[model samples]
Target: MKAVGVVVEYNPFHNGHLYHLRESVKKSNADIVIAVMSGYFLQRGEPALVSKWERTKMALQGGVDLVVELPYAFATQKAETFANGAVSILDALHCSYLCFGSETGDIAPFLHTNEFLQKESEQYEEYIKHFMQTGVNYPTALSLAYQKISNRKDTLDLSQPNNILGFHYVKAISKLNSNMIPLTIKRYKAGYHDKDFASTSIASATSIRNSLFDQNADISSYVPNDTYTILEKYKEQYGVFHQWENYFSFLKYSLLTMKEEELKSIYEVEEGLENRVLKLIIDSHCFQDFMEQLKTKRYTWTRLQRLCMHILTRTSKQEMNLINQHETSPYIRLLGMSERGQEYLRSIKKNLKLPIISKVSGFHHPLFEIDLRAAATYFMIFPEPLRSRLLKTEYTTPPIRMSY
Candidate 1:
């Protein structure tokens, strides 16, 4: 049986995501679809709008066969590392194809570009160093390198978020030498960063989230009925959505109390950034203000946010680097699954390479500890019932299994 894999951060699953899931199944002609998704924290180094449980339920409700947690170490990382973790999990699960939504809606150029980048590694490196010395950021430097080395500017348009991620996904597949074929579906309606809701069935997750944050606004037009219902239910009971500003005080407290040596040890803290962060934390008011104060040519907003997250969670660079060298993902933790997904898992149970974790006690790893700490930090912003309920150890939380 053929299976298609998708890497996602549902944030809150909406109509556009539903469209991608359905279209991916048709495009891959797969018997099952597996989604590797982020947990509470996201790639941009911010808390998710809702809990992972709610997001996983949204995925299963939207027709995903299986949903697995992308570990904290990799989920909240740069594009390449994020792709590597997701691709490694899917490849180990024996997925036949990797399906993703891209603004360009074509996979051929990404493939060709990946090959070119690999073939011109030395030249790319030289160009990257040269651009870095000129004070350009890492991503921009890499893009400049690609243009100089490949002379195929059209193949590497880093301005488009989906295109940038697609390139990294293909690169990760090649690095693993995995047999997964890459496929892309044209993104519909809104762009990744589009904040305004479009008058269409498919709206960007960003728009849907922004609407949800406003108490009086309606978002039914942007999301599936089940997703809307889930948000409504949570909004009534435990307060559903959150932005980084909600947790800024705790992060500020963390920074103020953190030692200079400890701050320096956190992942992504470089070039005496610990000292800069210490000085800036005193003057910054909100999360946005803090990010603005820290942003420079060397560090993008996203990179700075990631650094903030590391400080908040107290994740040391030593621990993260050591974990990455030792394991791609030590175990696959099931988050949610439909009946069909469970059936697929049953069929592959004996032949699987990585351990399928439905319970927390199934595996013990240092990375999992980091995930727990991250979850604790995320849940601190939530209300009492939810905060207490979700703060349980990984072993205690059962995977959400549903017939839908």
Candidate 2:
């Protein structure tokens, strides 16, 4: 069975994601579309509004054939590292292609750019380094470097989140030179952060999420009928993200109470970001305000989010180095799979080199418990009735509950 792979967060599955999942398999002409998904904490350095299990079920029911966990280490990282982690998993899955949604649907130019960067264009590297040293943001640095290297007058907009991630995917696939083909589907939404959902049938997840909590907009129009029904069942149970401010305070306290050197240990704290964080978090009122205070032109909000995630995950410098050395997701942990996914897994599981671990705790590895402990952090922050249930939510969290 030929399988196409997608790297996703599906933070809460929505129509746009469903569109991409369907399009990926259709475009690849593959029997299954396997997704390497983010866990409890997303890349944005925030707790998933909904549980990962819920998201996985939504993906399986919506379109994806299989869902596997993308380690938090890779999931909450810079674009390059994120792509690397996702791509590495796909490579191990023996997938025939890697697919993603992009603002510029045209794959030719992206492929062209990917090939160009592969030669280690001296001018590009120099241009990028120069911009970085200026403390210009990463997105801006890339745009500047692209202009210098391509010498093309076309305005390369790296500002859009999808485009930036798409570029990283292209770079990663090119760098690895793996067997997987690269595929892109046009993103249905105009922008990643558009808070307004138009009635155009395809709405961004951000817009759907915003409308869900917004007092005015009708969110039922944005989600699938099934999702709409499910959400209604759980709506009252949900907490506004802002309600979790006290949790962030707990985290800040956890940090400040620790030794100065201990604060420096988390992943992405390489240049003393932790030290800056200590002074910064105190002056700022809320978590968002604290993050805003720490933001830099050189560091994208996404990068800072990862920094926050690194601290939350307790990822030490040693762990970061260990992960970097591996250069690929260590294991393919199956969260859930549909009939087609099972067939695909059976077909490719033999050819894949990495271990495919289904049960999280049964596995006697140190990493298994560590990931679960991190997942527990999710429960601790949201003190809902679900927290009791989450304590029992193990690696054995069954084949997802799906409602057609």
Candidate 3:
């Protein structure tokens, strides 16, 4: 059985995702689809609308044959790190192809862009440093650097979010010397950051999430029935969908109680950012207000949000640095698998590079410990028995098996 891999967050698994999944299968002509999903926190440094397990059910029901957790260390980082971690996992699983949604939809541009960047790697770094020194943000610096060096009209636009990730995915595959063929499907109607329901059926996850949180809008038409049902069940059982604003009070508490030195130790807390946060945190009322006060030209909202997430979870620079020393994750955390997925894994089990972790009972690794802490922090918003119950599930639950 051949398998194609996809990197996803599946915050709520909507129509766009369904389209991508089905299209990936058709384009790759693979027997099964495997997804490496983010756990708790997402790439933009916000809590998932639902938990990982719930999202896994959505993935399975949506047609993914297998689901694995992308450790927090990788999930919350920038596109490069996130892509490296996810692609490495797929390569470790011996996948035949990696398919992603992109703005260009053409795989050749991603390949060409990556090759161009590789040839001018040193010059690209110099350009980025020069741009950053002029007060532009990292993303802006990257775009400027790429524009400065990229002479080919066929190269992808690095400014677009999905395009940036696609470029990085292709880059990672080359860096790892993996044989996985890269493929892409053009994103549907809504853009990555679109916040309104522009399309009748296809809507961005951001738009869906905003609608849900802003007015309890019905998103049944945008997502699959299974996704909608799971989301409703999660909200009913947990009292509210998870979001950054939900944890603002706790974040404020953390900011208030921690010493300056302690805050400085957190990952991404650099260049006197700890001082800015410590000074601004006292006067801010909510997460939004705090971010507004702290936002600077050099620090993007996504970057600051990731820093805040690291601080909220008490992740330190030392820990992140130690983990970065490794090229890939030590273990492949199996979140869920279908019958076909199970059979495929069995076929390749002996030749696998990483251990597949089905249970967390005695799993011991520095990186895994960070994942555990991230889960605990994610569950901290819930009250009493529910909080304890969810945390306990993290350790006790086995891989979700789908019979169909």
Best by the lDDT measure: 3
- Top candidate when judged by TM-score against the true structure: 3
Error of 2 at 296 (Å): 3.0
Candidate 1 versus truth, CA RMSD in Å, comes to 1.6
Ranking by TM-score: 3, 1, 2
- RMSD to true structure for each model, in Å: 1.6, 2.6, 0.8
What's the lDDT for residue 151 in model 2?
51
lDDT of each: 0.87, 0.74, 0.93
lDDT of 1 by residue, 1-404 (tens): 78999999997898889889999999999998999999989998888988889889999999888999999999999888889889999998899999999988988888888888888888889999999999988888888877776656556565678998999999988998899999999898888988987666778888888878777888888888999888888778775577889889998999899888888889999999989999999999998888887899887888888889888899998889965685467778899888888888888889887888787765778888898888888888867776787687444868899884
- Summing lDDT over every window of 10 consecutive residues in candidate 2, give the lowest-scoring window: 238-247
Clash count, candidate 2: 0
Candidate 3, pairs of clashing residues:
none
Off by over 4 Å in 2: 152-159, 237-246, 364-370, 384-388, 401-404
TM-score of 2: 0.91
Q: Estimate each model's TM-score.
A: 0.96, 0.91, 0.99
lDDT tens digits by residue: candidate 3, 1-404: 88999999998899999999999999999999999999999889899999999999999999999999999999999999999999999999999999999999999999988888889999999999999999999999999999998888988899999999999999999999999999999998989999999889999999999988975488999999999999888878788888899889989999999999999899999999988999999989889999999999999999999999999999999988865787577789999999999999999999998999998987798889999999999999888988999999999888999887
Evaluate residue 27 in candidate 2 and report its C-alpha lDDT on the 0 to 100 scale: 95
